[model samples]
Each structure stands twice: as structure tokens, then as C-alpha cells.
Target chain A: MSDMSRPGVIHDLGYRHYDGLREGTPAIARTLFVTGLRHVYGLGRSGKSKVMPFLLLAMSVLPALIVVGVVVLTGLDSLPVSYADYTNQTQLLVSLFAAAQAPVLFSRDLRHRSIVLYLARPLSAPVFAVMRWLSLTVALWLFMAVPTLMLFIGAMLSGLDKSDQVTQLLKAVVLQTLLALLIAGITGLISSVSLRRGFAVVGSVMALIVLTGVVTAVQAIAAEQDADSASTTAGLFSPWSLYSGLANAWDAGIDTFVPVDGAWAVAYALVALLLAAACLLALVARFRKVGSR
Target chain B: MAVVTGERTGQAPVITTAGLTKHYGSVHALTDLTVDVGEGVTGLVGANGAGKSTLIKILLGLLEPTGGHARVLGHDIEHESQEIRRLVGYMPEHDCLPPDVSASDFVVHMARMSGLGASAARERSADVLRHVGLDEERYRPMGGYSTGMKQRAKLAQALAHDPRLVFLDEPTNGLDPAARNDMLRLVERIGSDFGIAVLVTSHLLGELEQVSDHVIVLDGGHLLRSSATGDFLQRTGSLLVEVVGTETERDRLGEALAQRGLVCRPRGAMVAIDPPPSELAQEGAAHDLIRDVAAELGLGLMRLQPDRGHLEDVFLDGAPRV
Candidate 1:
């Protein structure tokens, strides 16, 4: 050890003030971005993601293969719906991908209290909210996009193209991607607010599947009661109805079958985006209050 | 700024809070707590659910208080928490480490997040790991480590950033006696050698008596006492004099003191004297009387000091014993 009495040693001279860089906006954002990457990668020394990407692909393709096998064996193509039409439905893609993957997106952090470590750092709650939502949205997007693309390509390679198949496939893929983003954003937001992963997952799924279905059923009953103004009655809440109206307006009537947009889809997207933003704001508020302690 | 620069003789307290109260629904975690923790090792002693973790969490900017305000290193906890977090390091009470990552990599990442450059972060992580006595085990994933090793790893990460102030909650919570002693020595070194301001908490008050310069005792959620360790250990105006002899010699000395009308009690080879204040006014008469009594009994005086209770007495009746 060096001399204790000098009081002028190179490093041990005295208590040095840490004249370091101030933690500003960029610093906070960089911390959040790194945390987002860590969330994607999971907590492992070997740099392997705890939640595997291939598992989601497997889940998606397993159902698709079963559907194709049933269609080929039973000669169900004689019905009005062809194999291509059945394969290119947004609802099937959404339910399959979302049913397995959406829970893990934001639920893990809340359950583990890993979010506390992030809030203790430079990242504020709002930044954490946006980053987590974006990370999950991207994760779910990749999980859904690749399998759907494979299905489309495989359908084209097969001998079942009726000229409008290409347009239909493109519409199906685009709409499914948008749907995944919207659903993942809303689910991730809802999941972040809760501490129990199971509760968060169940609550989010109920909000999306049960609540929306109830609203549509109520609107349909109202429309039947007022048959004189069926158009006005259907104006309330129907994502499928809204999309069908929009598709009918377009060259093809993809929306005629899909019915995910009109006034309802706009309202759904807007309300989802607003709820997502509100969740983000609540997260910020939570962090600010915690950090102020 | 004005308060920080004022002319004060003692080292500045890194954390000061007044009337700091925090309630969760009907349960109060901290109630009307006003404490000033100075530089060096200050131990916050209390049992579980006695507000030790709550206090540390509040200091680290992880929980908001229901009432009152506090400052850490002259920064308002409400407005300048990000700044305070940068300056102060915190070691939490629980096992929050990611079990799959090696201590070295995780600590380095934590350091870099605190604004250290890549090379500096790596170097500091290595140094702190060593300082906390982690050898080759530092490279192993925390999942396989024992509880003692995990606590060391946690402490290493808290110090990786070279923070000037550190809040260590139950640093020796689950350690063996030997390991607890080692951890306490390391904590003492952090305050005395590295010159880092330390606020350590423990459920056992005796564990902190030798390490802490000042002690703040909390009970149920209220501040029971906040003072220097010596204040709690002050003499009750009674002297415990030990003589080198048999119990008869001690009894004889006690009998002689009682003959002189000085209240004396026999305690093994010692006699505890309760000298009257009027004797103190006789200008060194109390010292002379004790010397004469020991000489007359032909017994060697081994020790003489004003009687003071042990640190454990503070928690005996659940109030300030002093």
C-alpha cells in the first residue's frame, strides 16, 4: 500500500468529485434501448433468448399443416371456400400467433419485478413502456410474418392460382401484419400494468376477444331491432364489418369476408393506440413516483 | 447549495430526511422518520418489516413516500433522483440477480450503464469483484453459486460504478457467523479506506455496534432513536471497577465503599460504584475514594469505567433504553 500520510497520492489524494456527464435524454433512451434488447435476448449468459423464436414458428406451422392435411384428405375444396381462401384468413393467423405468444411479451417483466431495475436506472416509465411495446410488436410481427409468407409462396407454387390469388394473398398478409401490430401493442400495454403474468395475459385476451365480440353482438341485435336503418345500426363496433366495408370500397371485396375496418376499425385502432399511449403514460407516472422516493 | 457549503465541523451527512412517512393502504412502513446519516458507516438497525428495506428503497428512488421530503447528497429525492442514483450505489435485500449470467459480465454491464466507458467498466468490474473476494467463482453463472457468493456478487455490482455513497440492505442477512464478520469488515473498509459513505441496515443491532459510527433505530415503522453510537452508550454516572482478586476481595472492596456511604454492588471480581454527585464536587474525591478502597483491600484495580448498557438494550423494551 502507498504512504497513508502523504495525502497527495496519485489516485488516493482525496475524495474526488465525479464530474461526469449529466444523465440527459439521450442517456436515458440509450439505457432503455439496451434494456429492450436484453428483454428480447432474455437473461442468459450464453446470449441465447430464453423465449425461442423457432417455437412460435413451429406453433404457427403445426396448425397450418393440420389444416392443409384435413383439406387434402377430405376433398373439402368442393365447398364454396377453396384451400387458398381458407389458408389466407387473418383471424386464423391472429388467433394462432397471439394465443401462444402475447402473454410472454410484457408479463414476464411485471411478474419478476425486473422492471424495478430498469426504473432505478436512467429510463423513465414511459420510455420503458414504449420500448417494451415496440420490442413485443416486432417479436410478434416476425413470428407471424415468416409463416404467412411461406404459406403464400407454397400456395403459389401449387397449381391453384386463379389470377386474383396474388392480390388476395398480398391483402391478406398486409392486413394480418397490421392486425398483429395493433393487438400486440394493446396486449403489451395491458400486461405491463399488472403484476401477475397469468392475470395480465388472461385480462388482455379477454379485452381483445371477449369485449370486442360482445360489442359486435350487441350492435347486431340493435340492427335487427331497427331493420329500417340497418346501415346506421351497424355503425357501432365491428372490426370485421369496418374492414369489409373498406375492402368493398377497394377493387376487391376482401373486407366483404374479413369485415375488420370501417368506422369500427378506425375506432378500434384509435382506441387501441390511445390505450397504449395511456398505459405508457401510466408507466411513466409509476416510474416518476418511484424514482422520486 | 447553501446548506451543502455551510461551515460544519463534522463530515457532511449524505442522507437527511425529516418526517418521512410511507404507508401502503392501512399498513405504515415508515412513520415520522427524521434521521441524519453522516459520512462513513451508519447502520440502520431494525428487525424484519421494521422499515429497513423500505428506507433503503426510498433512498434509492424506488418508492415514493406518503409524506415528508428527504435529500440524498444535497439532491432533492423528488426532483433529482436520477442524479442521486448516479451518485449513490444500492445493494438490495433480496436475491434479484439474474441466475443465468456470470457476475463479471452483469456487473460490467451495470457499470457501463452508469456512464463508465467500456474499458473502464470492465476494469472496475474486475476490481470490485476482487474487492468483494470473488475469485474464479466470479466467472461462473450466479445460479450455481451459494448464498454467500450471491451476496458478495450483489455487493460487487453495487460498487462496480465507483459510487461515492452506497446503501447496503442486510448485507449479511443469511451469512454464517464467519461470513458475516468478513462482510462487516468489508463494509467497514468501504467507509474507512475507500471513503465511501455507507448506510447499512441489519435486523440484529449487535452486529452493527462495532461497525457503525452512528446508529438509527426504527421500531414498527417509527424512529425510536437516532444518535451517535456513543450517545446511546453514555455512562449512567455509575462506575464498574474490576479488581484482580477473588470474589471475597471484590466483596471486601464493595463493603469498604459501602462503609464510606458510596453505593457499591458486588459483581464477580468487580464492584459497581454509584457515587453521589456531592462527592464529584469534592474535586477528584470519587477517584481518590475508589483508589483508597482498592489499596486498602490489597487488590489490583484491573478496570474502571462508567457503566453503560450494551447495544442490545436498545431493543429490549422496544424503546430507547438510554
Candidate 2:
């Protein structure tokens, strides 16, 4: 639209030598990470790719918005949903978001042979792998953070007890971040191995949703039988249960049939970090193999 | 240094490999490949499984060779590969474009990966895509692009970083005849006009003969031949005389040349005459003999030139590898 933007202006500027600052490895990693994050939400991709992420996001925030509206209108003494419990209730949406988007970041490049383009640069395979994992981790965190932020804003506007809401919101933010990291790890590992998009999505769903359902059933049965140890131990198998187990341990207001305490509480946090680390290592190895090919 | 060919590339050595070897378990992908490749357009000629991609990967630090060492633009490929890759652009032989992103966006992203600042990346990406002949088509998603357009997009990304050298692996693989020529011309310009040293690979020896200043032939993980393209196509010291007449007239010319003590043989529609002995190598003696014989035989001469060899002759003559 400026003076140089006239329609008749020539665009064929031929090749010019770039003697500018060619940044180091950190710049490359940062660019890759940014591109990856944009691709996850379909920001720079096709319009069709934008549909699923936004639809799921809208579905996630709609309930929170409705809750805010009801609390403001009815003048309730306290909002029915706890700040930490909102993410728990919308677990399906969060899992669906992660399941649907992880392959877009991790699988497509490998499947389409585009990883060759990235690795051909000054970046190594390990750096590329870590950058991709970090992108998905941050994206998954943002997906949860947006809605949590909405709830916090709504609670503040509704004149709720400032200290309590802020404290519970801080707890929710902590739990969501840890949960995003763990889910990103599991989904990224699965998406990378199962290069096919459908297979990756199914594999991630099976891990995040179906496995958690199974663990929940086992925990319910164990708690009913008065075996607190067995119920607590059942949470170690999947990322969702690990999140809930950690939430229970931290008293983040999400109810669990069995208390995650003592050595088990420490074990939950340790397992989450360990699992994420393991997945990252595996991703780096997988990428190294792909790059070698 | 011992592996020097007949003609130098006239530019500084951009890539040099010494005793370079690579093996995948028992399969040798590259074996003891020692060569000094200088600045210019050098063609890496080989068949499908002849280790072209393997060597590029090792040189780019993407794969580790089993033994030996190499250097690219003065950086040791084994120890200083990051620096090598930083200066060298690579266009892989595979499909590397993601379907959902436009070519402009993809190229800008690749430029950034090469460490260009954001604005510079954008400016460079636009110029490169234009240079590669991608117009408004670059703005559209690459999913529906033709093979030629996709190839151009791939090429544009490689040039986006303005590398000092580029390793282009089979740039004309999927193109039709016209597109192949266009890509070759683009490659030529990239080497000459842009002043970037080029290492382009092609299985078609003849095509590379047209664009490459030097050609290195690899067969079954062995260095078959590495020389200037002109050397491969040099005259074999034999005169090919094409006659405008029937086969009988051509045979008559051959017989006359043979009677004159000149070793001559009929080759299709022409007679191939070996260089005369020094006794008969008098100035204009062989040419006068050829002219007089053709005149007396009532056969018109269509063409007269030295019999230049082809790159394919290297394989046919040696043919030791499968």
C-alpha cells in the first residue's frame, strides 16, 4: 500500500548475496520452534487446518464463559466449579487438542521427508528434535492457559474472594503446565513413531483418554476394596492419571478416590518429569535415525 | 592431490575428500573416494544406488562415514561439519515441501533456519522465489503444485540462505524434457551468475555434460572417473567423415583411404579414420588424401570433424563395476 507497493513495480530482483548476520544454532532453533508452534494452531497453514484447533478451543472456552455468565447473573455465593477443577472437567477437550495437533508438529515432517530440509542446515538432529518437542509442549500449555486465564478473569470480575481464587488459579496453572508437558511428551513420542496421521491420532487418544479411563476404573475398584496403595499405584501408567494424581497430592481441589501421599506423592512428580525426559530422549534418537536415512 | 584430474576448475577448491569410505554393515556405500572438487558447477554422476546421497549426507554431517575424512570450503566435514553446513546449501533429491504451507512461507522459514534475521529472510525468500521463476504461484499452498513448480520451490529454499556452495541432488529427477532443460539452465546460472560453487548430481551423463565444468562418475561405490567435462568429450584422435551418398560410396571412400596406408573403418554413414602415422602426418596430407578420394569416388562430403568421445564411453570402456 505504500509508494513502492505500486502494482507495476517489478518483483524480479534476481539473486542478491546475503552478507548479513547469519545467526548461530540458537536462532535456528528459535525459528524452527516458532514455525512449529504456528503450524500446531494452523496459524500459518491452510484455512482447513485452522478449523479443528479453533473449534476445539471454542468448545473449551464456551463452558467457562457460560459459567462466568451464570455466576455474574445469579449472584452465587461461590462459583460452583473450583478454579483447579475446571481443567479437570474439560479433560476431554484438552486431550483432544493434544491428540489432534501433535502429529501436525511431529509426524508430518518425518512422513513427508521434510525433515531433510531442516537437518540440512547448521542444526543437528538432536537440536531439531528438542525444538519440536519444546514447541508442542508450549503449544499444549497455551491451549490450557487461555481458558484458565478466562476463568481467572471471570472470577475476578465476579468479585470472588481475591486471595482464594488467585491461589487456586495459581495451582491450576501449575497443574496444567505439568500436565501439558507430560501429555506433549507422550503424544509427541507416539506421533513421531506412528508417521501416519490417523495412526498417530489414534495412538495418542488411546494413551491419553482410553488408558486414563482404564486406570480410573482400576483406581475406583481398588479404593472400594479399601486398598489405598493399589489405587494410588494405578495412576502411574498414563499422563492424565499422573496429572490427576499430582493434583490430588498438591491439594489442587480435584477429588480422587485415593489420596496420593507420602512416598507416592513424591513418586508422581518424579515420574512425570522422568517420563517427559524419556520421551524427549526417544524423540531425539528417532530424529537422528531419520536424519541418517 | 594425487587424485587431480587433467583440467583444474580454475577456482579455489571448494570440497576435498581423502580416503573417504562409508559402509552400512557389509554394504559399502562409498569406498576410498579421494577427490579434490574446485569451485564451479561439478556434476556428481551416478546411477540410483551409487552412493551419491550417502556422500552428500556424510559431507553435510548428517551421516558419519566408516573411515577417512573430508572437507567442505576448508572446514573438515567430520569435525567442522556445522561450519560446512552453515556455508553450504543442500537441495535433497526427495520431496521436502510440506503440503499445507505456501512456498514463500516455507522458504522464509528455511532462510531463518540458516540463521538469517526475519526481515532479511523475507527479503531473500522473495528474491529467491522470483529467481527460481515462481511468481504468484509461490503464495499458494504447494499441495497442488506441478512437479516443475515443486522442484522450483525446493530450489528456491536452497538458495534462500545465499550459500557459498550448494549440493543439489538430482535436481531434474521428475521433470519432463522441457522442465529438465529449464532446471539445468537455472543450475548453470546459479553457478555462473550467482558465483556460487555448485555440486549437482544426475544419472544422465549426457545432460550433465552440457552444464558441468567437471564431472565425477561413481559406479558401485567406486570412483569411476573424475575429469573436466571437455576431457570426457575430447576428440579421440580419429576423424569422422560423413558422406552424402549411399553405403556403397562410403565404403568406396574407406577403401581409398585404406589403400593410401591410412587406417580407416566405416562407422554407420561415415568413415572413421585414425590419426595417420608421423610419416604420413605431413601438413594437409591426410586432409588432401580425404578430399581427393571423395572427389574421385563421386561422393559429396556432408560433414568432417574429429570423433569426440561421450561420457557414456567411460562406462562402456571400463565397465568393471556392476
Candidate 3:
């Protein structure tokens, strides 16, 4: 089908100036947010980077899938585990995901000195810090949302009450978002500060996993010793305990070692919000200082 | 051969700084200095710790000057760094690429960071990569690239945004001889063919002689000289004579030339004569005298050549004397 007689000519169009619409900070932030989200899940990166995130993801989802299977085959009236309780049960896997993936978004650029490339007119240090935080928060929320969705679908398939399942699933979604925001702040702050992958991962694991474990153990001991206020106060020390305390207070079918009450519950919410805000402010300051020579 | 550089479309000097000073504790990284960089390829030449990198970072607005005023493309550096960032791109002196990403991905990301949309970022990344001669190798991860390829990738990202000006910080560092030549040629094309103004830095003064239209010499955080490249390579107005013998013959020739009237001295294996005396100022008078002196001494004269100045001469005795 080719014209054999005609000679092929390659035209050299010289370098042309760009005259198109150049977006501003919003567009730059959007692009960074999308890229950061994809990179955390190892979507746009090297093949080897996909292993740890996907492995952690699979491990987190497996228990929900098994729960769904059991409810479907036995034709139970309702699922054995509540949706809000699912994330708390998978806390170890969730903590590992945050620890393993935060470095991909935060530490690698600073460690490799590639963060300088992102400092342009539209993408300043503050905007970069906030967009990266948003990406990690959204990624974490999605990590919890998937299993909850599966449970909702499984419950619906087995003829559970639609309104009741929706209410509990909605509560779980809200709690997951709150939990994600706090954890993202902690991990992003740790990774940005460490600037070394191994140290960043270990620091995040200590903050999100080890610190939370200690808080939970202390809260359980306080509750066993008939100290209600101390147990409730200990739950405010970690992101995971705060999520569970709020869940139990809201009647989301989560049973905490000590029940969170009126003023203490308000303190828990305020601490979570203020701590996340403090982390973000610290990130902005860190980025601004690091951007200079 | 000199490259045919394009006009700068009638703009101010690409960069200007006045009384710029930077100090850390007691160490002065950049002292009270002032300079202006015009269009085309203006080479910032200095030795190590000569403040070349310090100057570039300050111009990019990434470092604050303790006291000074600077402007890039008419944008104030202190208050209007955002505007300067929009108009200029900087290829840093150190490694700025991650090992896991390919050149294509990284350039596209940088272009997007510069506010280009997705499709525009991709298109410009491809064009700039091909322009830097990384056509087929751009798809591989930069970790596997040679030093030359890494330099090219760095340049590609700087060019992807279509800025009016770019600052290249030691673009030929860590490159082999041939690769250095290639990189120089690419820097020239960015200025001449693409009509982009470039401010490139190098510690090697000789390398910029072939590509730079204007040269600025920095010595110990001070401005030694700033002028056109031709001025630094002018003829020294001295003639050198060599004989086909040992140092003894060269010394004898030098002594004989000096004994006669010409003020001559020994320069390595040659006898260097300052411009001949007024009485013997005829064009070839020095040549004839050197020839007769060598023949009479039973030494074969090998070469009689005029001495030319080099950019390196600026450092040897300081350009201030020159």
C-alpha cells in the first residue's frame, strides 16, 4: 500500500516557543497530588517498588474477603465483624503500609536531591508540602475504604437490612478519613525529616505502630485496674486509639477497653485535629528551609 | 568557528547584581560583588571555591544575599522570586535526579511543575530530550545512564519549560573529553539555534573559549574581569624562537639575542624576544637576527613563532596586570 517511487522526506521544524495556557499553583498542586498518590501505590514507578505496597494491600484485604465469604456461604443474618472494627483489626497492616510507603512520597526526593526540581514558580515549598500530604491522606483513606466496600456489598448480597448497613459503613468511612489524616501527618513529617529510607521507615513505624501499641497496652491495663479516666486519657495519646475511642462513643459497634465520655471525647477530637495541623505546619517550615542552598 | 548566535529580542541584560554579599559565620561565600550578564552564552569561569555555584544559586533566588540588589529578566530577586522562577530554569551543579525514574518521566514531571499541562509537558519533554541527543536512551532509568547521558537529562529538564533564560551549572563536570565537547555543542545550540539566553559556568577557563561570547572571571569571591572572550585571547606582542638542540643551545641563542640589542629571555626550550628595539623595528628584523645568530652558533633554527595569550594567563599573573 506504500508509494514506492516517492522518496521519504524528514522535515526539521526548529525549536518553537510555547504559547499555550500555562496554569498556576492550583494545576501544579493537582499534578503533584496525582503523581504522589500514584507513586505511593507504585503505579508509575519501577516494577520492584510495586511489591511492598501491593503485598501490604493484599494482606489488609484478605481478612475482609474471608469474612465476606463466611457470611455469604453460611447465610448468616448479619456479618460477624462490624465495618468500623475491620480497620482496627487490620491496624498492623495499615501501620506497615504507611511506614513503607511514606518514604516513597516524601523521603526519596529529599534524599536524592530531586526536590529542587519541584521548586518552580507555580509549585512553591508550601504548596508542595500540602499537596503531598493530601495525596498520602487520600491513599490511606482508600486503603481502608476498599475492604469496607467489600463488606457492604457482601452484607447486601446476603439480604442484610440496607439502612442499618449503610449507617455503619458511612460511620466507618468518616472515621477512616479522620484516621488517615492524622497518620499521614505523622508519617509525612517523619519521612521528610529523616531523608533516609531506612531511618524514615523505622521512625514512622515507631510513631504509628510502636507508639500506638504502647498506648493501647497502657489503656488496657488502666481499664483492668478500674481506672476509667486514666484509660480514656491514654487513648488520646495515639491516632489508632483515638479512632477506636471515637468509634465506640458513636456506637459504631467497636468496643473500647474504656468508654470515651463527654469532655474527654471532645479532647480526643481536638487533639487529633490540632496534631494533624501541627504536623502540616511543621512540613511547610521544613520544606521552606530545605528549598534553599 | 564562531557560532551564529541569535539576537535576544531586545531585552535587558539577562541578570544583574549590585553589591551582592553572602557570608556564613566568618566564611564569606560571596563577597561584595556586582556584575551583569548579557544574552548569548556568557560563561562564568572560576576556580574551585571561586563562588561560581554561590552566584548561580543567589541568582536563582534559592539563596538570600545578606545585602544586595539583583534582578533577573526585570524581576526583583528578593520580593519577586516567583516571577524569576517563571522566566528562568536552573540546572544545578550537583546530582538532582532520582535513580528510580526514567528521563522521560522526570522531564515531564519538571515541565508540569513549571505549570505546563499534561499533554504539553509530554510533548516538550520529547522535543527537549531529542534536542539534547537522548533520543533512544531516554526511556531507560537514569540510574543506568552514563555521565554524559545524565548531563543531557539534566539539561533536557531545564529546557522543557521553554524559558527565556537558563542557568547551566557546570554542565560538563564528570564528563569524558568527547562527551564534554558534545555537551559544549549542545549549550551553543540552546543559545544560537533555539534563541534561548544561557549563563553557563565552568572551572576550566580554556573550555569556554570556544563557546562563550562573553566571559566573567571570578577569583576568591571577587570579580577579576568581565569582557568579551576575544579580549582575553589577544596576542602578547612577543616572538618565540626555538632551536633543534638542547637547553644549552636555547640559552646561547637567548644570550646572543640579548647581547646584540633585543631584550630577550629564556622561555622553556625557546628564546622569547620582546618587541624589537626601535632601530631594528622593521617587520622581519627580529626573525633575520635570530636566524643569523642560530646559524653562526652552528645550531639549526627549528621554529620562530609569535606568542599568543590564553585565558589561562588570566590566572597565572592575574588579569589585572594584563
Ranking by TM-score: 2, 3, 1
Instruction: Compose the digit string of candidate 2's lDDT tens values, residues B89-147.
Output: 89999898888788998999889999999999999998999889999999898999999
Q: List the candidate 2 regions with Cα displacement exceeding 4 Å.
A: A1-14, A74-77, B9-11, B319-322
Ranking by lDDT: 2, 3, 1
Any idea how many clashes model 3 has?
Answer: 0
- How much lDDT does each candidate structure score? 0.67, 0.89, 0.87
Model 1 agreement with the true structure over A1-293: per-residue lDDT tens digits: 65666786644333233344445546656654555544543533264555454554576666656554554556443223322233334443444345334445465544544455555555556666666566566665555566555554455444345465577656655554554456666566566566465677577667555655665566567555654235433532433333333334343334232244356445545654464456556655654554444
Say which prediction, candidate 1 or candidate 3, comes out ahead on DockQ: 3
Tens digit of per-residue lDDT, candidate 1, span B1-322: 0122122247656888878899999999998788777788888888789898888777766788899889999988889887887777888777767666789988887776676766777888888888889999998888899889988988987887788898898999899999999999999989988889999999888888889878888888887776677766777777888888778778878888888878887766678887556856475678788888788778899898778866777777455322
Q: Which portions of model 3 show Cα errors greater than 4 Å? A: A1-16, A69-79, A158-163, B1-11, B242-252, B276-306, B317-322
TM-score to native of every candidate shown: 0.73, 0.95, 0.90
Residue A58's lDDT within candidate 3 is 88
TM-score of chain B of each: 0.87, 0.95, 0.88
Residue A283's lDDT within candidate 1 is 52
Q: Candidate 1, after superposition: displacement of residue A267 in Å?
A: 3.7
Per-residue lDDT of model 3, residues A1-293, tens digit only:
35556679545677888889888777778888999999999998888989998898888888989989999999999889999999999999999999999988889888888888777444778888999999999999999998889999999988899999999999999999999999999999999999888999999999988999899999989999999899999998899999999899888878999777788778988998999999999999998888875
Q: How are the candidates ranked when ordered by DockQ, highest leading?
A: 2, 3, 1
